[model samples]
Target chain A: MRDPVTTVRPAAWPKTPALKVGPADDACNVLIVGVGGQGVIMVSKVLALLAQSQGFEVKQSEVHGMAKRGGSVFSHVRFGKRVWSPTIPKGDVDILVALEWAEGLRWLPFLKAGSGIFICDTKRIVPPFACLNRKPGAPMRYSKETPAEVVAHVGEAYAIDATDMAEQLGNERAANVVLLGALSTALDFSSTDWERTVAEFVPKKTIPVNLEAFRRGRGWIEDARTSTPAVDVPAPTPATAAPYRIRLDINPAWCKSCDICVKMCPERCLILNAERIAELAAPDKCTGCRLCEWLCPDFAIRVNLDAPEALAR
Target chain B: MYIETAADFDVTDYLRKEMMPHFLCPGCGHGIALRALLWAIHDLGLDRDKLAVVSGIGCAGRLSAYIDANTFHVTHGRPLAYATGLALARPDLHVVVITGDGDCLAIGGNHLIHACRRNLKLTCLMLNNEVYGMTGGQVSPTTSETRLTTTTPLGNQEPHFDACALATAAGAGFVGREVTHHVPKLKELIKAGLEHPGFAFVEVLSDCTEIFGRKNDMGSSSDMMMRQKSEIRPSAYLDTVDTPFRSNALPTGVLTRNDRPEYGAAYRQAASARAGTSS
Candidate 1:
């Protein structure tokens, strides 16, 4: 709800931060990782604005061109006395905020080893690419690490159900704002300043809901900092798909020797017999996509993808 | 639009069952195109009695007789002319005109343009076989340049007419082009045209395997169909998605669509405003 035009932050920036930049380092690098449309860039904008207002030069760079279609989206916000490179070096990210669970695992190597603060949402967004396996019982290609394991690996980590909390607040889209609220705790910014900046970024009507979401997220993180983070129930095992058989009925009496079924078949398993009638020569090669039946001008071809288990008498 | 599972759509349900082994030649793409039109009608859940399919004289014209619903087999190149009057008279009827390339673009060229100009609520499906198959294989307006028809023995020298482009230029509200090889895609295109409120002109690239293919040594019915499919590109994937279309590929799908005022609705509004009496 910022500018609704600029890909980067269009909201008013906060005034100051706690000045937590290490003496050995020149800037504080916070990496916000999430799938596109999760408001990763928006969170980075808030951070950049707060740092800039604190008299520290802020350099924010992001990659979100493919974010609109559920693609990987990440933004780097570095603020200090004078920032140079817009990108954070690998293993140098002071804090890593992940809007999605799998993406947090994917970008784990970038977090500063043994010291980086890891705040991740327990929301699982199985991408379209993960469902490519067509086998009956094949498992999806996704991260297998659980919250317990991920928390144990990182020096300090908090896996919160920010999405569910936002949904309970009556806006699933505010999930990103919730993640932002959790991120605000990792920085030195004041609570009131963070809330005011979030209010500016979000729509006027949803200000009340987002403010409550921010408080809930801030509370969840604070509780987890003192105790163990709660683990979510693992993803349900993929169900075995129905086993279907491709059955083709080609009526020779009606076939006009058009050779359409034989030639247009995607598998090229169809052939003309001695009488030049269409026949399923290699039945095993047919996938039952029904290209033969649909293209047959003579209406001599009929295909059925029947459940093999149901057909057993 | 949602794609219906093929299991739900049966071509025989909409067809006069006895008409099986239709007179169309082996591998004639018209049958496939006909199946798409019927599938669209079936998917739309249109009432059989409320549908009026009108056709002109050609291979495409014979399609009207096979439909189980009401149909009109009119004279050559006059299906659109007849459809305009029929649509105005009975706005409730889903008037669809089925005509071949020769029947639509050549003989009934004037009617085609005027139909576009009027922007009536009609779905005019022009099946472009590129030849007059029913008339013993002659050159048609959509016939590609340097193609062999009985009339063009030495490969046609005239450039083929882009039917969808013509309809678009003539001010048709909705215009689309699709191939018969992809039956489901063709059905989806036809369905979109049917759903349009104003004049919808769909040019289906069909094959006359027996006549056009044999005369041009175009291998077999499947070969001709595949060739046409390979040469033309689906309109939906021209941008963003990777496409098989090369430089010479003819784009398909709904090419032109606009919010032109439909003749029937405007006519009714005017008549009611003036007559001020119930019909």
Candidate 2:
């Protein structure tokens, strides 16, 4: 594996200036490759929707090959002054966004030689066939490879730990949005444009965290660009400050006792009581992060950081 | 056997004559089901102006386009919701909804259950060809585990939904299932469903000869019709079998019929009662 320190190389930016206007002959072709259920379709949809909102003609096609069963899925998105075809011709893709490292390697042939930008999620899911023990006279064809190795083959690829970043932001599913954020930096789109599209596409409850994930991704790229050469760039750790004391109060009447708050607590600080309502099991472990509050479908649970007892503590 | 000809069975009065030459592929059972529906409407002697047919997007959904009536071709999996509104507003109109397996059981599942629970006065005819024919034969909710589709290359491991059983359990006042091969019986069921006061759900086991049939090795259109004729047993035979579906015996008749209070009539009654109490 290449050094984690060198993974964030400084001179990896595109040589050509990012195109602002969609030229007739030079439509940008983006190929998003990932395993099924990785939200690759949603990412392409958001891209197409955003492009259409900006007065560009967009054509998108998705191939769902055994998508629900952890098989390969990809979408081709072409946008320009006038997009004629839904598919991008082979070897003409401008940007290749792979949600998995192996998928990046698998679809590398689609990228244009020497000029294409490869952005890959550093998450690797071992396919089922790869993990099965080999039988006599029959060998397994699957092998594991690092993101660094994939980046090496692609000549210049950006490897971002999008899943880890999304988990840090309290939802792993927002990794797709995080990749979209990194994509926004490579393209000539503004944050306001992305924000508006995110609001329009993402669910109303998830808008805040998804937008935060997008900004974090954009900021990560910005930091890599401005930093001095050879300086080791560490992953951005969002501020996680826990109050000295906190209390969780669940309104028993409102609580249908779905056990969502009890199950979703990262610290295991909440529990279901005999009445099947949520009860604070360990107040000291409560971080006041409000994950329970956000996850609770019913607005029954409340995190009280400013209780008199908490203040006294 | 009765030899019927086009001249004797002229449904020209109920068809959009100009829209003909229809778009359904040869050997498609959707056409058969459409003919059955048209025959049911003609048999009932229903006024053409008072009937409204709604359909969602699919090969089966295209039935609304060909029928010469007040038809609304809504988005995929949403015909039931639209028909519900039309039925409520104009209770005099007989609103019928046509949908495919994927459109009704997969995407429109919530609306289906709610419509049944409410016992709305609407006839929902779900055509189960066992594949999503319009999208080039993707495996749908009704596609059996023994079958294969583009998405299920290795064979479908997912359990299929029993649409008739689901509708029965969801509180539909009338529930029936029939194969397109049994056109006479299918038409009778549709006619009975149209007369039912509450939610009437009929599942038609249609054939997709081009996509589903070719993939499953179910030979020509005639072969499929023979299979349907031999496979389906009477409703009484279902009780004697352990697993009717596994035994290759599907009951082709009215499965359930109840007399639930229709939603529109109940709503109006409640509203008038409330008004009386306030006065």
Candidate 2 backbone collisions, by pair: none
lDDT of every model, 2 decimals: 0.84, 0.78
Tens-digit lDDT track of model 1 for A196-253: 8888888899999999999988887776656655555575467565467778888887
Instruction: Report the Cα lDDT for residue B248, model 1.
Output: 69
Q: Report the C-alpha displacement of residue B121, candidate 2, in angstroms.
A: 0.7
- For residues A1-313, write the lDDT of model 2, one tens digit per residue: 2223333322322234454454344677889999998889989998999888877788999988556589888999987766778887888777888887678778889887766778888777668776343222223344345554556666446778888889999999899898888787767567899989987888999999999999987776666556522222232222234323455667675565656466556678888899887888877566665656534433455555564555767
How good is the docking of model 2, by CAPRI class? incorrect
What ranges in model 2 sit over 4 Å off? A1-313, B1-9, B236-248, B277-279
